[model samples]
Target: MQIDFSRSIVDIVLDHGNSIPDRTALIFDQGDGAQSSLTYAELATRITQLAGALSARGLAGRRIALLFSAGTDFALALLACLAAGGVAIPLAPVGRRKARLQNILNMLGDIRPDCILLDDSMAALFGDELSAALAVGPVRYLEFAALAAEPHPFAALTLRPDQLAVLQFTSGTTSNPKGVMISHGNIIANEAMIQVAFGHDQDSHFVGWVPHYHDQGLFGNILQPLFLGSTCVITSPAAFINRPMFWLQLITRYGAHTSGGPNFGYDLCVDFATRRGMPDDLDLSGWRVAFNGAERVRPGTLDRFAECFADAGFDRRAFLPCYGLAESTLVTIAVPPQSDPIVKSYDSRALAAGRAEESKDREGVLELACCGPAMAGAEARIVDPATGAALPDGAVGEIWLRGPHITAGYIDNPAATEASFGRLDEGAPFLRTGDLGFAAAEGFFIVSRLKDLIIVRGRNHAPSDVEQIWSELSGTVGQASAAAVEIEMGDTQHIVLIAEMKRDDARALSDEKVQEMAGRLRAMAMERLELAVTDLVLVSASTIPRTTSGKVQRKQAGRMLMDGELTVLAMAGPLAQAFGPSEQGASAAGQSALR
Candidate 1:
């Protein structure tokens, strides 16, 4: 499993094609019992042919935007672009949604790719939109099918370690999207780290549904398998969202050894099983490493999932809570395979004060899942955000990382690059991840995003902690996705809770009943965290926006609430005045009674 840093991943593809041409390299599950697979020979041949075609077209060092859905086409396009010495910009296929399409168009305008690569089917589907994209700049469209039809003789291009391979765009949950420059060396180093940390080899199998545009899906689910010359089974994100059980079924069918996604994916599976009941024949014994990353790994989610599927031969030790971002090229910290996730209860007040204090008692405690130590050849440190002084263990601060896997910086944005990637006190270069966490003996425990921290009366309250507490208390709110944000009112900062209620619950509750529930939530917040909930706005389900990676966009939610963009089902407290005049009058009369 030793990775050769001297050779690029393109070279590995060629080697695999030559040595194990008959072995299956990739499989795409169509989610209806139908699947497609490609052998190593086919993959390498296609990549070489398409790469040759691209190079022959004078696109050796140009930016190519891949706009294919998650499938063999996307995988082939990405590898071929890299092989041809072109910068690959993998983007999710923009469907009919205007907002999503506009977002893609905006990104394209910023990147200004030389050519947009798509399959024949995709080009036909988005024919009109593709026409509109031409207005952004002088960009040509290249179909993979057309490129593959005419194969040209191609010689492997010499690649440098620092050569840019991918422009991974951040999910933009907290800010506008910026492309993270991932070098060839960064990918190789991170792949090696993942192979060692996750205990993967050629015999290992992977099945996942994370979108290939995301780093986790592209690197972990796809490239990592290629790195080990292993088979990887992939399905679209829609397939997994439509039926979470299909993800589990794929693992069962493939006897996959490594596969996972964000905490929400596990939560969905658990919820699906809870309502429909788990199938008795399903077995997950072969699942050795179920990594949870790209978002906070909730301990409750892990516990519920393990208990829910225990009868199906699912092992609790298979859970690997990890922490990473696109800037790291994929994984930075990951728990070893077959290790039980580390969970600890810390005093809520101490964590709020930027220090971790272990608490044995059940009252006023926050249970956090530990994202294990930095991967091999990587170093992680917690430093005070204000002074850049390194903090000792148990002190919550910004997590700084230094490793070969760490990407250089954001592309075309030197100010952002300078601000994010810097040396700590004249030491080695480190990526100042805007995440807040602390390192303990076990590993690192993420608290919240430094930007998402809700401050009220000068005390830092992690929005995740508040959201979790609200979720536990809000019974039958139906898919309790809550966003706790700080809204400034007349000379005072107020803690506002915007939550989603099921359609059934939203229609069944009377105005009086909604007020009562809001009052109870406010009372509970006061009793539990000693923080007053200034307002509670209940909206329909899926109202809150989330990044493609499933991280809640707290900042965007606050903006929507202030802009009156959200459709409110019910409201309580002073902020209710923003909803309408009737609510304003009602709130004015009943605000005192509720308080």
Candidate 2:
């Protein structure tokens, strides 16, 4: 069924809000450790009030920036913006708010948002620290608390289905960020896809500590729950990052039956569980659909997560492997929850060579896990990344997808937009995802992120290849790690390995001792992988600024290092003197253009 998104997302919310006024629509944790509840009626009222405030400021049909941390206000404000027929751009509210703020400002200069909405405290912070956040000049601005205080007023704002809803910016590999313009129709399509994929109903409840700014966090945790009239338990991403196991514990505590995250989340669960172990009385029987999406789903991580949580009533069948990206709003495919999660293993060489070769994954060790077929309207295909020729089954190539949920194009970037949308060859056009993968009857295998691939000396080396070696080190690092990548001098690729002690103590930084650890990593790369490293940057466990979804922004990490903010620099004694010869050094790295 086609949707008339002309009514805007607010219309959908009002429909459900009126019908489910009594339902526990939103359960949020007040940062101070207290819990707060907002029913459908209450949230709708908040949206109306916020929308009225925004309307008073003439924000309709204009682009608006939201700089927020997390919690109830963030959700309501986003929905309110949708209702007001404004294009919402949610940005990271952490870090030197100025740096991210300036980045957002630069983007707005291109798209030209009319107003910027920021945290009540952050607005004050910028007002006091204006010089620090120098990019502020044009555009109106509003603080969070101020908008909340405005009176509620009914407004009839219509939005076409294809009208831009949000500008979700994804970081470029070596360039500035690009914003994907998600439409109202795409939002509807993805919500329906997620609703169908999860096989849930109004009775379903979703709980999460995922960031509201991320596509997965916003789609799975906020939009899906609110759109379906399901109960949602929300918490700060910081709370979860600080304690990842709380994601699992929350499922048991609130009887939330629907949830998912990236592979690292499950791995973290295993890492935490093995060291701390699950609570003896933990009950995860209520979890009906525990899915993993938004990032590469590793098979080993899934297997170990099952092993660690087996005693806590966690069922392997509850895990559902899936695939998605911001271009699709959120979901593209999701396997139905099963009793025993299955992973299809293929010989690594055969996969890279664009052919199928079955392999035995050590009796119990998990190998490959394929994301299922396109959900609902989406169509998935494999095309050679370079030639744009469609590949047959069992052949590896770039993954191309198109459906109702696919974004129209990147905001304000016609070149990138046209280039990314479709490729023409032999009179056929297809969206080139840049991702390399292939289909295998039941589902598709996603090899890796296209942008993250490293082309060193003509050989493609996945950063994960080396990072895995460090991550798997015995009795050290654990899961608390950060891998920032930068091209060194002379066009040589350099990876800065950063890991803080699990105990989170600065005294743990014994230079010579950590150098000894770096030596172990250097040996693995040189002898086993034939790679040279320039430096190792070690920081406290939380120094690395991730996307709250565990995605390491290498550029951000490099900036931290260049600014002399790094905590520890561990360089292999050999390359320490050969920095001038590295390709990423001096002029080579700075002059090289991004592909």
Candidate 3:
């Protein structure tokens, strides 16, 4: 169970390649019926060749940016960087759009990488534009074919565990992304932790469609399998988006023991199964440790998914709710393997006041699923965000983390790093997670982000609680909904609800019907959560802004609502009806709810 922290990841790969040269290391199912396989020896040779090529170009101890569009090329490029003693920086692929192109350029500016790896296909896709942009920069661009240019002596390369391995960029949902510096030691520790938590052995298999750019994709889909010396079936992110069922089918086909994504993925599967129905002859008895993380884990989604797939041999207990961030090297806490995820409801008002009192009233409560306890090498604690004081169990506060899995710090941002890494007791290095949660007898329960919590009359309310209220309308709520603070009528902030309409129903329903539905939603919010809704906007799908990983960007949606960027299909209630200038126009009861 102990990971040799003194050894680099490459050492593990070498041992596997030498011990099981003929064993399958990776299986690529492009989701188009095209498949490819790589053995341990074959993959090791390719990685060593590419590493040698990178070393020939003076990339050793320097940063190497990977710009491939996923598949064998992407995986090999990452391994090559580590093998060649270069820090790996996986970048978003180049696109013609000005914004995406600028993002790549901005990343390049920050990393100033010695070389950038571009697969043959992507090199041809961008052609002149990509070549011209790189021509002005000092960095070198190497094609995938260049990996064959006289395989250098990888055996002579020196590898260090404390050296930089990866620069994982934080998900830029709330702010501009910053690169987190992950040392080789961090990767080794986290990978071992994951192997233990998920029970991944050499015989275990993995199937996932997560994009290689995200932390979940890199750590959960790619690195963990390699660390475990197991076979992993790969597919593109577009594949899952195009057909959510294909992800599960791949698991069934490959007899994969582990596969999962964010809570939204499970919801997507349930939605698709409802419309398309489960495929005939599908079997999932072998599937285990269905991890749910990188976002809030919804218990309702878990229940719906289990019920929907129960006929296909799916087990509800396979659902493993977890909590993690890129800063902690992917996973900090995960539900122990083979255990059913725990869900509990708390008094909504008491939760707002930073207490975890069990709800007595069934109608007005906030339900949250536990992400389980801290991982093997890590410790998690709740602390007061304002005073850095440790909070007792059953009290909500910011979650602080300390472990070998934790990153060194943010790259080139001393002030931000210093502000993020604060001490709790006896000067222990704890990374301030900026997440609001509470620890109880069961485990850690994530309530919401500290910055994202909505405050009205000094009581904090989770936006998810309000969003879930509207989403309960089921047929009316589409793919996503957002509740945000709308600062209106001179500094007074009221909760603004923006929902996406189902595309099919939006086309058939009249404006009157939409307005009636919104009225119902407004009434339900008032009755259930004891909150007054100022304005409700029902717009078409894609109206509510979301991050690349499908998380609702509440701040961005709020900004879009204020700027009139979203196409408003229907609107209900006055924008400032809750706090209008004329006291006669406002309801006395609604005013009391606001207070």
lDDT of each: 0.84, 0.70, 0.79
> What TM-score should be assigned to candidate 2?
0.85
Better of 1 and 2 by lDDT: 1
Q: Estimate the TM-score of every prediction.
A: 0.95, 0.85, 0.93
What are the clash counts of all predictions, listed in order?
0, 17, 0
Candidate 3 residue-wise lDDT, 1-595, digit = tens: 4667876777787678899889888888966878888888988888888787777777877888888786877888898889888899988662345666677767888878887778777677654566678897788767777666666776546677678899998876676778899999989999999988877899888997877878898988988888878898889887887798889889989999999888878877888888888789789888888999888888788888888998899998898888999899899988888888899988887888889988757776777899999988789999999999999999999999998888878999999899888888775589998899999987899998787777877877777777777767754322355554544444555567777765575657775776777677767766666666677666667667666566777877766655556665555666534333321223343344334
Candidate 2 lDDT for residue 300: 72
How far is each candidate from the true structure, as Cα RMSD in Å? 3.3, 4.6, 4.8
Which consecutive 10 residues in model 2 have the weakest lDDT in total? 580-589
After superposition, the stretches of candidate 3 with alpha carbons farther than 4 Å from their true spots are 94-98, 148-150, 476-485, 502-508, 576-595
lDDT of 2 by residue, 1-595 (tens): 3544555557778777789888888888634568878999988888888888888877877788887766777888898898888889987665576675666656656766777787766576664453344346666667778888888685867777888899987634334667889988889888877787778888789988768888888888888888888898988777766676777777777888888777777776777777876666678878888888766677777777777777788788888888877777888877766645557766554554556667675321215677787887678888877777778888877889877888887876889888888854432345667676778887787776666665556544445545665776634432336563645545445665655444344345465776787778777765544555545645555665565356765556666544435443333343345332221232222233221
**Candidate 1's residue-wise lDDT over 173-290, tens digit each?**
7888799999999999999889998888999999989999999999999999999999999999989988989899989999999999988899889888888987677899999999
The segments of candidate 2 whose C-alpha lies over 4 angstroms from its true place after superposition are: 1-7, 30-33, 97-111, 130-136, 171-175, 361-366, 424-429, 456-459, 474-548, 554-568, 579-595
